[model samples]
Target chain A: MSLSIFLITLAFIILLQAAIPFLLKRSIAFGVTIPEQHMKERALSSYKRFYSATILITGTLALTVYLLWAKNRTLSEDQVVFAGLAIQFGVLFLSMIMYLYFHVKTTKLKRTHKWGAGLKQVRIADLASHAKDEMLPSYMFALPALITAGLLVYTASQYSQLPAMIPTHWDIAGQPDAFSRKTPFSTISLLLILLVIQGMMFGINVMTKRSGIKLTSAKKKASQIQQLAFRKYSSWFLFLTTVLITILFGFIQLVIIQGGMGNAAFMAAMPLGFLLIMLIVTAIYAFRVGQGGSRIKVTVEDEEAMETAFVDDDQYWKAGIFYVNKNDPSIFVEKRFGVGWSINFGNPIGYIFLLVSILLIVLISFFS
Target chain B: MLIQIETSSDIPIYTQLSNQLIELIARGQLKGGDVLPSVRSLASDLGVNMHTVNKSYHELESKGIIRIVPKSGAVINPSIRDGISDEHRLRIVEELKPIIAEAIVLGMTAKEIQHLASSILSDMKEE
Candidate 1:
């Protein structure tokens, strides 16, 4: 594949990864109660997304530059390759800046008396206040994503001006430019546009999380239906991104190989493999999303019951105490300590190990 | 030291820490004036928030089981004073009355329960 083509492909993949989290965040934000801990989790996930994108864009750009220098005898002196690299690096650098900014802001918010005090108070109003502050970091985080999308669209526009093929009318060199031409913009724009949409989705999520009012009895059923629809939408979003990338890459490879080498056989095998992988991943993700959504529903129900009881007893002062009632079987005894309380679902040591593994993957990809 | 926290258990973490430490002290496993791990260190090691550990330390301090200096860390109390007044003894009995009643209902004779209590005390002394 040409260096330009490879860079465009990788950019799309990174964009897909970026978009997935935004969609997931939106679904979660809209469907569940926005606890302080959930906000922290969202921030952490955004960091992961930023880290992944940095690794991907850096690795692809480096490889593309090397390939252009070594393999492309005709386009070796082309400034387009260098310009593309500069744009990619600019995006990567901006992403890092945004990541750092969000990280610092979140850490400050976490340590500050106001955020900590509100969480401790655990009132509906207090949580809403914290959620509002949480949105500030997200807005800061989205800046880099926006910048990358703009640069990508510009790069794609420039690339479109290049002739369909250098030597032939339909073929670029000996390779057909079918896939590149079929998509008017480079794949990079496809990915970035998706990312921009993802950003808007995350905004919706933040709104849902921050809204403090309970769903009225009439709205409860509708809300449940909405939650289910959102969950399905998120699942399909991830599935479609995976499928689209797989098909686009496969098509590009086929176009590069030019129509003679058993195209039908390769085409048949590729989509089957893609579908298998997509199904497996989508199943796991869907299950997790469903489980998390149900848990949120139960929590919301409990909160409603507690609110009603508190009002009846006129125990306004005790309402924010956040005590686990003695009769509540669902309250975990150890989680009351308030630390490592967010690390749930199994042994703490194992959970920490998984988190470390994810961080190591990001670091490895970043430096490689 | 290994600390296990079962979130689903009825006992709160701080109470669990207190009871476990008290049991350890009663059995002479933790010596007087021995330094306990700093709150932050222990909290991170145990994958908990520092506030949780701080609450446990405060409880221990109030019971004179440990002394927490602002920056110097926690230390086991040097003296185990036997300062239970008569009123305090009555208060202790008052707390135990419900448990004793439950035990009686569970089919233990007075002599048997007394004998069992003595044996447990002897076991503690041996440890």
Candidate 2:
């Protein structure tokens, strides 16, 4: 439960995930149109390679840390090292399962349209129609990572005060401390939450991909559900953590006032201040994430008429002539209709900037 | 001669290729009876689907612009001496009438429209 180990694991996962998009981009650059049948195969194969490399490196590092911490230490007969290993293995298995599920779902969607049919004449209008469908599964694929990260954070915190070796006692009722009292419950809760989140994300992915435009109406309902979930989780976390910190602070103040102005108060206050700052930062980030979720661009074009329209739900920007006027065929009828293309906040450049910023932050964290 | 195909353009690849060939012929850049690349060879060279190049050759052949010989290659056809038939001319004029009306609607006077047409024709002749 060392802080360094947790940070190292986080760094490994983020770096590996970041490289996935870059690899896909490289394949596209090489003029290899990953055919529908092979898209998942190629992606999974690449992911396996990345996962193996990461596991090998991180596993060695973790083993070294364990050896250093638990040197010459022997656990009692009931003490088990297998619980942590089981959780890690379970998370990995679930990630693979989620990946396969999405791959199959996206493959099925592509097959329904037939090979090359959608891309053959590929008008801008076709892209507009297909954008929503294509993007739906991406969020699903991201679900496993989100679930795993959440589970890991919860597990880390729950097991933070545990010694390097597990205790021999099996009875929670006879345990000496609160940490030992709820150990089994905490572990079981973590696993169940992971499973539920992963399953829900997969279900949402499949349902949305199948429902397509029907999901747009459902999306509004889903958003309300999501907001509720956010509020529920954040408030619960804040309330519990706030209570725990306040109690800890009160204990420190009692000791400090008795001992007469000492370092204990500063130590207690430091973490409280740090927690408040983290909550504020997380709130800002969550707001930005919500803002980014709602908008998507749609490109429309007519190849025959040589016209193009870039539209979203709220606004439409069209360029080129839709038709030559019958009364004035000699004069081309053109309309450059859009509120303001430049003013649109949700452009491709913004996505690129966000991606780069995330990468920069992850890299900086690694070095730090 | 190499004819590039722009797949992402609004115009179909076949039409683009055919137009380029026609323009080359009209400018005497490709002379009558000159040999052209085989469809498969041209398609491979241009990194296009073979069917695309085949369609372009077919369109050119149908228009009497190029003659395709089996296993030999395509060759430019001799220019036609006679002008379009009276029926065809009338059909073209019928299509132009609406365009003329459109020009009038766009604030072009009849004389101005006529002048513009003549100038375009003269420019084409120079090409």
lDDT of 1 by residue, A1-368 (tens): 23545455446544533333343332122112223333455555665566556656665666566556546555543454565566556655655464456445544544453332332211111111222222233354344455445545554555545445321112323332343333433334334334544444344333332222212122233334333443344434443543355344435333323434435445545544555565455544443443223322333332232221100101211221132232111111111111101122222433454455556545533332
Report, for all candidates in order, the number of backbone clashes.
4, 4
- Give TM-scores of chain A for all candidates: 0.30, 0.25
Model 2 lDDT per residue over A1-368, tens place: 22333334434433333233232311111112233334355544564465445544654555455445444556432232443344345445543454445444434543564533333322111101223233233343444445455545545554654343332221222221222233444333323333433443343333322211111111233322332233233333333333344444343323322333335445434544545555554444333322112212223222232112111111111111022112111111111110001111222332354455456545533332
Off by over 4 Å in 2: A1-368, B1-13, B41-52, B80-112, B115-127
Which residue pairs come into collision in candidate 1? A332-B7, A333-B7, A334-B7, A339-B49
Q: lDDT of model 1 at residue A18?
A: 39
Interface DockQ per candidate: 0.02, 0.02
TM-score of 1: 0.31
Best candidate according to TM-score = 1
Candidates' interface RMSDs, in order? 15.8, 17.4
Candidate 2 has a TM-score of 0.26
Worst 10 residues of 1 chain B by lDDT: B1-10
lDDT of each: 0.44, 0.41
Please tell me how candidate 1 rates in CAPRI terms: incorrect
